[model samples]
Target: MTALAVGCPYPPCTVPTRDLQPIRHSELRMDTHHRGRVLTLRRIAPVVKLTARSWTVTQESSSGGTERLEVILHRSNHGQDILESESMFMVKEPYYTLSDQGDPTLRIDHPSDLVVCTGSLGNDISCPSSGEPGGAVAATAFAAPVTNTAKECKDEGNAALKQRALPRALAKYTNGLQLVAKDTAANGSIACDLHRNRAYVNLLLNRLDEAKADGTASLTGIKDQEHQDLDAKAYFRTGHAAYNLGDFQEAKSLFEEQQRLAPSDRDAIAYLRKTEVRLHEQATGEYDFRKIRAGLSKTAPRADAASFDRNTEVKKSPGRGHGLFATRDMDVGEIVLCEKAFCVVWGHEDEALTVMTYDVRDDMIRGFPAGLCKAIVQKVLNNPSQIEKVMDLYGDYQGIGKHLIMRDSGPVIDTFKVHDIVARNAFGPGPVYSGGPRAEEDVRNASTGLWIRASYLNHSCVSNSKKEYVGDLMVLRAARPIGAGEEITHSYNESGDYDARTAALKTTWGFACTCALCLAEKADGTALRTKRRALELEADAWAEVEHAAKAKRISIVKARCLARSINDTYEDVRYNGLPRTALLRIRKWLTEATTRDLAGC
Candidate 1:
């Protein structure tokens, strides 16, 4: 039999001297000295038993020593190498062995204990009979070391805390503290951050005490300017809580602290001021909230009017109910309801005429009635209470200088009632003195008076009411049977086309018009376009004939036909680029012809 060479690849004292033994079918066992420790082989198994050809061993010791060994084993058949053996072992220090049924098991007797081993060897040696061909043994084994119990608890607690389980996080933090017996930086930092976030959430839910407690917790282990800033923010939140609870004084104090901390912060300053004002009002007993309620009650319009019978029903549009309806059958001249003007502003020019300091020498110009104007002006000046509110609401008049006739630092003019009514009712042809060619010759005047209920009428191209001024009062007569709920409308501008009317409505009233006249006019655009084109052609023909007449070249009969065409085309040519003077001359001629034509009959 060939003598088997059994030697450890590890250093001197690490060699194995034991019989071959198997811990399992494919596993081998070994123990050796590594570094200064007598380390034991726990177990070894070949990943592929038939394929392995060479073996390697590595060892580590308790005293921080390491050893590496490689051994080549071979099998031969008829002087030829059939299979080269392979093995590998990882050995820890303080090696030891156990035996069961002639199979030796290798392991570390004490994993954490200290041990010593030999460092150097001089030569290789043959294996002893008691030693295994592929195994190892160590001199002795040491005892196992102890571990801290609290670390496990801390780890479990931390895992729960990371999942945002607040209760679990607190428990973990407590467990970690119990193990370490003092605050740790990692655990303390996490706890502080978590508490701060929790405090904010609690504040949102209006749990004031809870929020304050959490905020206090957040301050633990936090220091310096950041802590003070956070404290200021917390005080601001506390102020908000106090404010919501109607504790103005407390709120003010907190907000004042916030302002001191952040002087430039607008929100803090505003809250502080507001709370101070409220507290001052409370202290002085100056906040008469009941007076405000009474004033609002007095200003509210009466819902029940005596004029309309409650039992009567008026027809209205399909979806909309009746707004205002006639309670009784009324004559044409009957008054509806008298209402004072809600507000009024004198025309810029009229105000200028009244406040003038200069003397008027021109007889053709009419001066304002000084007595009435003065009384109105004095009323405006003397009524400080009225003027104060008005000035505050609308701001000061920048155009006052432009309209001033006299600079009395006294009261403003108050003659709004008559003038305002007149303005509402006044409607006529275009302004005669527009700054065009005929501006010097044209004289424009607005009808002045105490305009009746007709003044409140709305506008429409197709109107049911006819308005006429009698001395100083405006008279309105229904031209058709106006239904009870129908609005009393008037034509403000007779010359306005559909688009012009719609535009005026939108500008003045802030709504798109759905009036019958607007609907009809919009429907007529296609037909109106054709008619306008024909009118343009007729106007052009008339212009040529008028040119001939101006040169005194056209015959009398031809001139008459052309004059007729001019009258028919008046609407089409009125707004054209014709010089105002020339247009007026042509208008005068047309008037004369029409007058003659009427006289001949």
Candidate 2:
């Protein structure tokens, strides 16, 4: 827990999906006479300042769908358990600013960005120019290739791959692929070629399944003649990787198809024969490819959970407890983090189980299907310690803002805690619908689940990030360019007048609003209270208006209604468009930001 040895000096072969919590280092627990240097880090404004020594940083992409913007210190330690370390704190992209930083020993930028200026290679930092920190020049395997602007990126990627600079190659290939998405050329040939080139790079990186997937992507829109050549190579590379992965049947099919296309590819024929043999062995239970399959590739759109942006980490802020912060420069639309949902329960039912209360026997947990209720409740019933873990989350659900007089049975507590966690941190189970806004009825009808790590992000009315549920994953994309060391924040309430948002935050999640918009609107007062109390106040106001109307006090009724309408126009100004407007805005902003960052515009 004290010191974490940076484990990957040589880089890892595969990038595993990281958990947001502490990474396990039990396997790294070692008793050694030679101890690696310990690099202790300290935090300043938004940068994790290196107080120990001036260390060089590097940017490299891994086939595991992660890009390591910085490296860790390697150490030899005597321990027998996983080394619990804090989230990595550092900022990565837009390192161009460091080009003039004039410190050779100190680096505020990644080495890859200084390749043209810093003509050196190794672990140490170096800079031959003013304000430029340099260590190892990025891989330049092949001399730069001259090609049309559309093909320029892929050609650069090819050179990086020859240099064995897998990460840099990926970035270039990805850049090319992005351009292809926007291109409207004949038969989409350029896009196919990009996929085919990326597939080859992935194959070299040992990402077999991703290579196969990319290979398949290359086959789309193949009416163009240029793609015909790419198609054969794509299939051949995919088959070769699949063969190594023990996916013999798939390998066989791909290899056979490749040979048919090339007609004279002896390598494809040989691989096809080997695949047939492996398939026969598999059919007879002579081999188990599970272990190999597990390491094949990560095609999912997330970095490892333990993986943080070079400048991202856990820090404590007063009032809100622990939250995420940037230690370095991050571009708008950067992926700060991605987490898998710890629990993904949707349409769960609890109709038969209700908590007893005064005036009412119990509150019906309706809208949830009966089958889902049993399944979820059973999961809790089977797990004895579920409540304690669930309680570790923000369980400020003062259910009805009243004391729960229900019996202390474990299942009942499970229901209460689960309800609290869901209310505070859970997002939807649908794509886009998960974290995006929803109608009150649509929310009740949809499924919801919790992603534990993402729960640490605090609320901001004028948030800089977009938190969305994309399929089973919770993604956090930067909405605006974030400076290093700045806090990462997202909106938890709607774009509306302060009072209504405050009430929702206070009544539902049990929190007060202090974000910029809230403070600007002078949102003061504890809006937290019973849900029914909120309804009661609204009802009382309407009742008074109704009474005045009946008594012929038309002026009073009109004044009250007009005041209410005028006070609630903030929402109309922000989101009066169709529901899809929010979705479109998110897409446009994110796409533009990403393109700018990658293309270095």
Candidate 3:
């Protein structure tokens, strides 16, 4: 077996005397010891089994410090080494095993835990030269040793936190936690304080699960009246974690407990309101969209809205990877789903925040839509438990179904993988924009977000549903009655000639739309295309005249006649029940004109 030592050195006595040896099928053993503090194992080896017995030190160091083992698995690809998985184990219980398991690659208990890969790696892949992997590493697992007393470590942690050195503070808090003995009432109270403080740090670090665990742990084994403040904070932190984790009921319960403890706490009061709003949204798909939209900010682009709907489900589509299908019959104009974006970049306020990368090979400009990849990466980094929201969506990345590995520093994430997902799945600034040739252009220039469930609804020219956006919230409504088990689809583009629509879909989504409307247009051949071209020209000429007519500078009667003439062109069975771009424009203008005329009423 081969091993590479990494991380800072510890006192000789703190180092385990025995070596971590490879375990066979039924036997575990310890081998020769290395003087270094950290060990690295390559999966290329037949069986790399690391057990904790050989890694823990028996004698307490002079500083009363301890060391925990963190295992980080990485895979090298495209000259970049990205994290595959990470895990932390206490020194006394560090047993972990990795095997080829018939596939001759990698196999673990939790296959879905691995980060999505951009593509298959070549045989020449190599690890990075640095000892530590970069990006959002957890600080608690390898904290420096501190004095044995819990109070001293807690004080040090508090001081570090005040200085805004989060990672250092986490180390101190973790060290204090290790020294705490929770057997007695006084000691347990001290333990509670340490747990609550540590939970706050974890909450800041975006380690939601750890924060909740610590917060809940702090609430137990103590009932001191003097510690009410600490208990209140613990409840608040746990509630925040649960809320972000989409557990509204638990969050509400936790927040209510905090309120009971700290009646006048304004923060607790604020969270209770947000929790109630989410609860209401979950129960009923109604929302005050205008209020939500007006609430967007640089720090808070999306509200803590509930993404709730039970009418649809995800299932594999024959050609598409997956698609959303109606689980129950839906009536026209009924809400299909109302989903909050996984991440959104608001462009209306910050028009300069866009990132565009031109693909030389593909001969197309791929819009990153305001560097949303960074937002996604930061979101996953903060609350890694929600990574499934980003990873399970469609992307060019082929690496999936791998187990997740966590390191002490944090979960290893590949920005490129996230970038690929964002580029492929992000939707525009808003669903409603100006119509005509400029509509696609308007969508391209607006804000964009990744809505996981909504992405599964495939595209159709004459779609069964229509989607609208309110801030980052996406509301899908049935445009026509849909039957149970019917696949939900919506048009991805504005109304245009068949050639323009097909070309746009092919260039943007890489799929030639084969919807019934397109098939009918295709079967009509050249004569139909010629007639449509003539109508398009006539409409363009009439549009100029209609604008003058609306301004009262031309005869409105001529404009009305021209509009009726265009509407009659689509009266054929071929265009029946399908979107008529020409008629839609005319109807929109007439409706607006009638509304203006009725203002006095």
Ranking the candidates on lDDT from highest down gives 3, 2, 1
RMSD of each: 39.3, 25.5, 13.0
lDDT by residue (487-542, candidate 1, tens digit) is 55556654334465566554323245655545544555656634544554554456
**Per-residue lDDT of 62 in model 2:** 15
**What TM-score would every model get versus the actual structure?**
0.24, 0.32, 0.66
How do the candidates rank by TM-score, highest first?
3, 2, 1
> For residues 67-106, could you state the per-residue lDDT of candidate 3 as single tens digits?
2222222222111222222122112112233221221111
* Native-to-model Cα distance after best TM-score fit, residue 389 in candidate 3, in Å: 3.7
Better of 2 and 3 by TM-score: 3
Residue 128's C-alpha lDDT in candidate 2?
Answer: 22
Poorest 10 consecutive residues by lDDT, candidate 1: 118-127
Best by lDDT: 3
Flag regions of model 1 displaced more than 4 Å: 1-455, 483-486, 506-512, 533-601
Q: Residue-pair clashes per candidate, as listed?
A: 29, 19, 17
